[model samples]
Target: MKGKWHSSWLLLLIAVVLVLSACSSGNNSSSSADNKEEATSSGEPQDGGELKVGLSANPKTLDPILYTGVYESQIMRQVADTLVVYNKELSDFIPSLAKEWKVSEDMKVYTFTLRDDVYFQPGEYQDGRQMTAEDVKYSLERSAKESAMNRLRGVEKVEVTGEFEVEVHIGTPNAALLAMLTDSGNIIVPKEEVEGWGDQFGSHLVGTGPFQIKDWQKDSEVKLTRHDKYWGEKPHLDGVSFKIISDPNMMTNALRSGDLDVGTDIKGQNRELIKTDQNLELLSKPALSLTYLDLNNKKGPTADPKVREAIYKATNVEEIVKGVNQWGGAEPSFMGLPKQSWGYSKDLEKLKPTFDPEAAKKLLAEAGYPDGFKTELYLSEARVPYGTIFQNQMKENLNVDVELKVVEWGTYSDTVAKGNAPMSIGGWTWYPDPYFFLYQLFHTDQIGALGNGKGYSNPEVDSLLERAVSETVDQNERAKLYQQALEIILKDVPRIELDNLEASAGINKKVQGYDVSSDFSIIIVSPNGTNVWMKQ
Candidate 1:
């Protein structure tokens, strides 16, 4: 083992460097919309314009129960309304479909008073109808039973207590229930639409949000139009157009040509181009996202624990992070949790694995692979740069030849979930709650597409996670439990975390009222529906 590195201090220093660099570049991109000049701020926010946004990949499905990738959630978020939503600061929850809610002292039972005014968008299943307590019961129960993400894991039952009131019973006191509800997996769905479309439910979706799915041209675009009967204030824009642009270069070009109002997942040279462009403004935030390299614990060569450890030792995670995010959009990390999260701690940082190529070689030899073995690294096209850097590092340091397998986004996720990918590079973005990160990613019950696709299982880790959610409602106590679990997970070497991503986007300055969110929920439409207006 090697001695500890001052990664925490390094992160602080990098942050300072980035700040100074931004100051030097006078019209640089910013995290706040206030920094950019809105062409018509003096007038009332304009309406009736279609805002076109670019996505990095295609969504696999629109059904909350089955969608796996962030690309899908990004679109789904516009159409669906959760019981509650994260406040702008992400400190507490605010009302959405649920007007108000009360939790029992034990934290197992929650009573929610639904908004009687909310209505589902018009669909073939039914002409828009009022949403009630039954809708909450249906949505929560469906998510608890069949969500691909295992979102409502501890939900025991959901009962319609009254026309506008429902009670959710948990098997155990769950502290992450609200946070989980904020995820796309638990978005309220109408029973009629879900049963009416069946397998095609996602393709023809209906929700009670300000926007509704107008059309989805597979692999081309998902067009959303204003929901006329929405309970909340009508949206300032007529609709949103989520254009599927897989290539980063094409995405940038679209934004530059004014074909797209917003371009997401902006990286490398494209960020520089946006910052320098007078017509475009950059929006960036230190995201609550982790990019990682998963070492399959149940497949082929990586099945050997020593091989997994050797791979960790062989990796220079810092170098790989720098090489991929050259424009200061990510920070090297040793664990799954992001520094911005409340659960992130200095104690956990102490357990970061040391990079020692000699130690790696010895371990590989002891694992009965005197000659370095070859393996496939599965990843999406957007992750090719990360794969390339990792592929080269393994070859140079450990003499391990890595075959880069670039597949489509949906295929890549399915392949990894099936444990067919021996090695892979992936990323996860969610709210600040530790359970959203640790429990879903490391818990035994979360195997496959639910989040633990690496086939990792640890009883001790599972117990800690359960206790963290059910045993305590105190923030400090829950954080401690999560930190303890993360410590154990890091030692297991199930994954080599590359970095905590700094999400960046290029936006047309004409599109006003935008703020970057750490969770990757880029479009922030206010409850009053006053934000996200297009400049006339």
Candidate 2:
């Protein structure tokens, strides 16, 4: 009987073991199923990749604010992230580092609340630092003192309230001030590193951005590595390389050859080639930008307002837009800036800049250039948006004998600063603010043989601009004031209003999300984290 009982107990133990084994198998199956779903959703490819780009020329300076126009901004963009960034639609400014902001009742102070989860790009000395309010204070204060023309000059003080709060207290309310803050020229840099570098900091860049500057072969390539410790989403692409090739046709070649993922400041007949290519994609958008001839009112024939007007009437701005630029969207610039921007007065539309060659001839006769004058139009060999092509076409179309004095961009920059270049094609990257066109170009503070090439100063324009800065609360009201201001500048014709260029680009099929904008800020698509990645 004892033997029989022992055998029955052993059988019961065996049954319990079998039941436990089945339960374990079920759990293992569920865990395996979950992992498979996660892998599918994440879209993780077996290997990450690289993005190669074709650049128009080697950037002369990496200093964000000091450099103006398209090329420098494009390079600085990859290395830094601004407090406020322009939208993809180009309609307005959106929160970036500062998630939300508010203007004081008096409209003088702008207080910004930073998002909690933010980190700088990783460095060799440290892994990464969490973004703090002090960084915001550091960015604004240093930038203000760094230049004579900082928009922050209106800002009285910048203070940190807490770990993630910054207050920008202005001496007076400027409706257009906040919009200027969105420019890369006004980007916030890490204070600890930037205190003493001044202009030299352009070479050594640091920021709370998606990529870290790894290696630079000046004029050859600019290489950046993705930061795994990035606070936001990590880039899908492992790295990005900018190859300096000035020729637009060569840039197109790189894109078609599958060697370059992106190209910037693309224009002319090359534009038509990229748009028609089946293997690639085209991302084009109207930037808040306008190209105009900078007539030095400080010297020469342009000093006469009538000559400036006749020059305006004589130059075929519309033909340059339609003929020189093989692409379609570019329009003749009628106002100081594009019609889409704020402070854009329909007041300009009422006035006309028609193709009145006969009227221009009569005006020239009145200005004492009856047989047409001899003037050397200084042109930039910058390879930016086809400076050479535009200059050539413009010379042909103007029906006037004008000599071309083309110079390399680097040499031209120095020569222009010395007040040597007589008349050169200049451009303004219009931001969300109307003051960018009016104040910066015409302000007494910037007037120079070099900086303020136009040398246009009006006490009335200044008075209204001052009123817009000190008293206006509503943006639309400010826009109206700017419209009033625009009527004055356009009437004065300080510039030969040329083409309101449509920024064009050629993108390799692999570059999934990319585009060109008036601001010419490429980082907007990539953001600090989200936009970059490998497709498979």
Candidate 3:
């Protein structure tokens, strides 16, 4: 009887154990399902997705050394890495290919210590070669050629001190060298690969960046794949494709239609549409660019300082800024450097020219043009509105009849560079340093090809710019020098400063982890998509 009772108790215990196990399994399954649903609903970052970007223009070249356009730089940045990069706010410099660096007491030499873990992406020439000091020396040497804009003008030589260390010697103490190195043009590439490819190096990019160029179709699209061997954190997206859509309207439509994850260089007319779209996000910021009417100081009626001043006084900047830039607007400017730049002066208002038609007429008469002169204002399609506004303002105020010549972007760039345009609407995107603003645009050296398109040069201005670049290490001192230079430029009136432009972009809601830069350069925020991810 005792044995039978014990057997019954054991059987009951087994049954209870089976029931508890089943309940626990069911609960675990339900919890997992809920967690997965939460992840999906909450828009959590997921791995392995593709991001499609719409660009307003096609990238001219993929070679970092040859690329001069903003769009080209944006694409090259993902495939190549520079030694240094600007911080998120572009207020300070941070490490990139070079892990750390040191400068000499004289500030003429810079030494960089390369990272050991960095390896080039697999390619025909690069069999996963480890990046070293030799590659740095080779890349810098190749960029110093004349075709490369004499980029390393002040540099004496680049030497490989150790296996993973390089030293750069400069002729003078250049304060802009460090800042200039942050440019995408100074990216390091594999030396052997560049040599092997020769002239075709632009098409075959091999670097230690987050993305590798998988395919490129000129004037159409460029496809890139993630580099699994990247030393930094892997990108969440499997790939990114840049689709070249020259028309701003088409780019905006593509973003709205879910065909594009990002649309760049959104024009003023499309800003309202993008803002109103529920599925798109509008990103706007003040660009570090100055759009102005450039009067050729080399020749024509504008050669006289009085004529330039008259034109400056006659034009109404506020009207144009408000009328043309309706959505993503701009601020009226009195000088070449934008207000956002470090060296811009708050006291610029004192030198700013006010709109006074009487004073302009008087100046024009004094310059031997009492009735005003007729001239052609060359412009691209993008700047037609600004050109028209300027023409009407000049006609009404100064009795000047200006004919507008609308041309393609390529022709406009070439014509301006050749100093053929007597008066034209021109724009320049300046670097972080005020010296770049003063030196590149106003210096006598950069007359035809690179900068100083107006051929405006002053002895005092040149001296001040030279001093600002070489004579000082203190930022405050440099700012003072630049301010002095700017005063001279404003007085001379070579270029009538119109306004500092504002840039805008349309981003799809599906894209995440992207920010527009104050400088209007997408590359400034994220040279590579390591921090950018897409919602699954």
TM-score of each: 0.77, 0.76, 0.87
Give the per-residue lDDT digits (tens) of candidate 1, residues 227-309.
88878777888999999999999999999999999999998899999999999999988889989999898888788889999
lDDT score, candidate 2, position 118: 79
- Find the candidate with the highest TM-score and give its number: 3
User: Would you list the rank order by lDDT, best first?
Assistant: 1, 3, 2
Enumerate residue pairs that collide in model 2: 173-469, 236-533, 287-518, 288-518
Tens digits of per-residue lDDT for model 2, 1-536:
99999999999999999898887776997877677556545664323677887888777676665665467667677677778776665556678888988888898778899988877765433356777888888778766766535646677789899889988887767777677677667776776556456556777677776677888898788888876765555666787888888888889888888878887767767777888899777777666777777776767777888877776665666666666566675777777767657566665765645666678777767888777655656666542443444445434444455566777777666665555655777767667577776777765666754445667777777777777666775767777777777777777777777767676777876565555666666662354323755454
For model 2, how many clashes? 4
lDDT agreement of model 1 with the native: 0.86
User: Which portions of model 3 show Cα errors greater than 4 Å?
Assistant: 1-45, 146-149, 296-304, 362-370, 405-422, 447-450, 523-530
Task: Choose 1 or 2, whichever is better by lDDT.
Answer: 1
- What is the lDDT, from 0 to 100, of the residue 409 in candidate 1? 80
In candidate 1, how many Å is residue 412 off? 7.4
Q: Model 3, range 312-367, lDDT digits (tens) per residue?
A: 88998899988888875578877888877788887976787788989999999999
